[model samples]
Target: MQLVVKPVPDTASNQCLTESCAWHGFDTNPPFEDIVELHYTGYHEKKKFASSREDLGEPLRTEIGTGKVIKGWDEGIVSMFEGEIARLVIRDDFAYGAYGYPPMIPGGATLTYEIELLRIEKPTSNHKLKPSH
Candidate 1:
């Protein structure tokens, strides 16, 4: 399903991730893959009309491991390197879908997370997933 995307401001504002982030700028060169730890500061908006869910606050700290986080987080953080931060404007489809959570997150929630890449731990065989029969 195609979502109506809102254009993030070209100039970095207080409403954006951090002072140094390229808020709406595109990456000309992509970074290598590894573990990236970040310190995010942003808000989470609930799309659906569920009054139970609350708006998540800013400056939220999160850890992103390969395939261990939500799709938005996975895709959003991959472009960043250690000490790099960015504001991730996530659509509901990229977030929690139809199933709404009570008193926290709602269905079809669109959120914006200001993320910082704290560290990147290279993938090792010790952390590889074993095949399931």
Candidate 2:
């Protein structure tokens, strides 16, 4: 299994490259702990299997760094801006692994997803409340 990141041409200016992942587009930066809304299509061997846009009624909402999603998504989407759309080619190791995710995804699959960042809800500020009379 192999993973590769291809930066979008127009979003190159906002592109941030790392050893394992790359992100593009422009908007507010989303921290690892932030809850994000996204639309994604999942594929295996160039065939559409599942899509948040089609199967799910609403956009996928999850916390970034809490393992709510795949490892690749957590690593790849960090610091990504809201409204950014990027292609993520994730290896089995970073994804569902050799066992895969059961019937929907076969074993040892190399998954490709077109992830669109729809919105980001930052962690609310922690402030102590005053005592009531």
Candidate 3:
């Protein structure tokens, strides 16, 4: 006799960034502590903040799950496989946070990063990474 419907909440909201961050991968994901070399462009509020290409001859290098990078990067990149390119939508809590990076990122800013996982070097491998094209 009566019908009522409630509006659905957006499940992809930043509240679930760890699970909601977008990623596309073709190969297998590397394990934690493995050295991963990647090329990435960071954007803040739709404006380009930084890019690995800006460094030239050197892409960003870091160990996944390590504390060397922002929490977002560690969490976002872990799901990626070698040669996978993706956009990682990172919440402010996972980024520079309230203080933010001076003269660049602002407080409570949600950042997006377009990254390409170029190579993964496990501890046992002495392989070198080639420049990204």
Candidate 4:
């Protein structure tokens, strides 16, 4: 699969990855961190596989730079501002890899996602939130 990322004009934002994956989006003031809530549409082989839209109940929440979600998502979601949307394309190595994720994902498959940043929440105190496994 092909991966591409480039600067978006005068915006300080830039592509996150360009080898195994690619992402294009804007940067937030505080940057994506400790925790975030967002919506996403996941696609495999150009077919809709999963999503976290409004109709799908609560928006998904996760900690950044943590292995809580797929590697591709971690690399792509950072630095994105709330209300910003972007496309993240990832190869197998950054996704579920050769073993895949059961029936939802296949071995060595390339996946794409249309992710929208809904909110960013920083920790209230100095205590850090533990990364969910």
Best by TM-score: 3
Error of 4 at 43 (Å): 0.2
Which ranges in model 1 have alpha carbons more than 4 Å from their true place?
1-33, 46-65, 128-133
TM-score per candidate: 0.54, 0.73, 0.74, 0.71
lDDT of 1 by residue, 4-98 (tens): 23333343331322223543233331233354444554355523331111333323233343445565666656545456546667666655667
Tens digit of per-residue lDDT, candidate 4, span 8-126: 22422223232222333345522435687788888898998888764467677677766777776776666455666667777787788898887889999888877777777885666
**Cα lDDT of all candidates, in order?**
0.47, 0.67, 0.69, 0.64
Query: Which of 2 and 4 is the better model by lDDT?
Result: 2
Q: Which structure is stronger by TM-score: 1 or 3? A: 3
Model 2 C-alpha lDDT per residue in residues 1-133, reported as the tens digit of each score: 2334544224332332222223455758678778778888877888988788788866887778667687777776774568767777777777787888888887777788777888888766762222110
| Top lDDT hit | 3
Scored against the true structure, residue 79 in model 3 reaches a CA lDDT of 68
What's the C-alpha lDDT at position 106 in model 1? 65
Error of 2 at 17 (Å): 11
Candidate 4 Cα deviation (angstroms), residue 119? 0.7
